[model samples]
Target: MTAWLPLESNPDVLTKYIHKLGVSKEWEIFDVVGLEPQMLEWVPQPVKSIILLFPISETYEKHRAQEHEKLSVDPGVFPDDLFYMRQLTSNACGTVALIHSLANSKSISLEDGILKSFLENVKDLTPEERGKALENDKSFTEGHHELAKEGQTVADPEEKVNHHFVALINKNGVLYELDGRKEFPIKHGPTTDETFIQDAAKVCKEFMARDPDELRFTVMALSSV
Candidate 1:
């Protein structure tokens, strides 16, 4: 398995990488200063998706294992149109999270390029197959490599990265947590386009609550430019 460099949570680098992958300039990634009501109110309207970068601590791992076990037995409802893929390569969670954020966003228009083509080709494939496809895509890999080096602090590809990214998106009026490392998207609860930012913030707070001593969490939103 290939291990690419981990991506920084910086919005400038993320926005540039997405643009290079053919996301229209009309949308861009912005840092979520705070999860409070006043802070969320300052965020640009119509947030397409929310990405949370959190530490993979023992507490989180225990919860994740328990949740996976529970869901494996009783997997709840998720929209058929919800685009998701697993992470087959190491240190690729950032790219996978961005892909989830873009793929599920109906309002964002993708130009004809790597992402557009990849999504079209994998529309009919299963989640594991989609992961393999992304792993073998040289063009996408190259793009990821180039941008991964543009971050503020470049880390070695083989270095251990304790942080992971997951995207929260609203599909068919339900809030789905998309994590490539997970077996399937976790449906949080009911949400609307108008209340997505606030709803996602609540989930983000839960993540923080799990790791109260950790202050490395970063939250970003994909919204209007």
Candidate 2:
């Protein structure tokens, strides 16, 4: 069986691919290099979602298991309209993160394109079903594979990578961690248009805390112009 290959974590590349997926240019993405309050000063306002790129290690797996065991993910607590899906294949987490961000971003209108069509088709399906649909989308799936090949030497399809992307979005006054690999959206805490940056920063920091000695974590945000 062929699996999806990992994508390079380049902001420019990511934004370009996001644009190709039909997200408007008005919905820009900016890098958030630090978790400090000062880092928020330069970030554009009305941040909708925060994307986290981190190394996947045994430590992360342990934390994932622990979090799953300890935290009760009340899927219903999240907004009824939130869009989420499961990662059914390896190396597709980046695409999953992009979808999670775009799907939940209410302000950005998706133009007529593959993403819009895909969303329409999967609108009523369950998360697992949506994932299955994605797997079968040749045009969209192949587009991602092409993007993954740019700006770096393409690795063999069997080669494994340790990094993944996860998105944290605020919807209906609540903060949700939308990880395709997770069974359900994780409710971190309350959030709003005014406080989502700070609220998401807290959750991002907790992810860092889980692997304090690891320094491979990166944080970025999707926001209005």
Candidate 3:
């Protein structure tokens, strides 16, 4: 059996790591808590991306296979500029999703920081290669380690869990789901800058509908201050 690393699913932890990496001062993350319209009313506007936490399951595997088949036949569904990556490590999904949200965001400047340096190093590489590069990135991994320690998540390497994180963002007027586990970015449907939250909420509903009986899922967004 393969060993997987552990990660914190708390949005606060994610926000801490985001700042630690010096992604951008303009960007902020808040827990969605609930997906209802009223709950969303509290979130700041001009949201760049939504991050989801879900438990891995056989049903998710089935959905992934179905989505992969569809994407194989219609690769154009995703925008050409979508930054996607395959999660090379089991526990790295959260990092991958966080990076996906930040790296592809135009509202926030990734100009000169650890993230910018990392992105520059892998800009020309394929998504898979980018994942590998991220796995080996010392600065980024060290930050993740520090945050993990702060979160008290460091544990036996043999421990395993099913939780995972993915990001949803709008690019070229389309809503795309960036899951490192997926072979490519999954384009759900059309969405404009103004309506991305509502559209993304609809997609989140679809995800909820996929496994109606399961309730181990969460949604958070990265928005402007």
lDDT of all predictions: 0.94, 0.85, 0.81
Per-residue alpha-carbon lDDT of candidate 1 for residues 131-225, written as tens digits (9 for 90 to 100) = 99999999899998898888889668989999999999999899999999998899999999999999999999999999999999999999996
**Which residue ranges in model 3 land beyond 4 Å of their true spot?**
1-4, 152-156
Task: Estimate, for each residue in 134-180, the C-alpha lDDT of model 2 and write its tens digit.
Answer: 98899778878888888466645688778889999988888999998
> Model 3, 52-148: lDDT tens per residue?
8887788888988887898788877555567788788657787888899988887677656788898889888898899888888888777776776
Best by lDDT: 1
Higher-ranked by lDDT: 1 or 3: 1
Instruction: Name the regions of candidate 2 deviating beyond 4 angstroms.
Output: 70-76
Mark the 10 consecutive residues where model 3 has the least summed lDDT: 1-10
TM-score of 1: 0.98
> How does residue 42 of candidate 2 score in lDDT?
79
lDDT of 1 at 132: 93
Which candidate wins on TM-score? 1
TM-score of each: 0.98, 0.93, 0.92
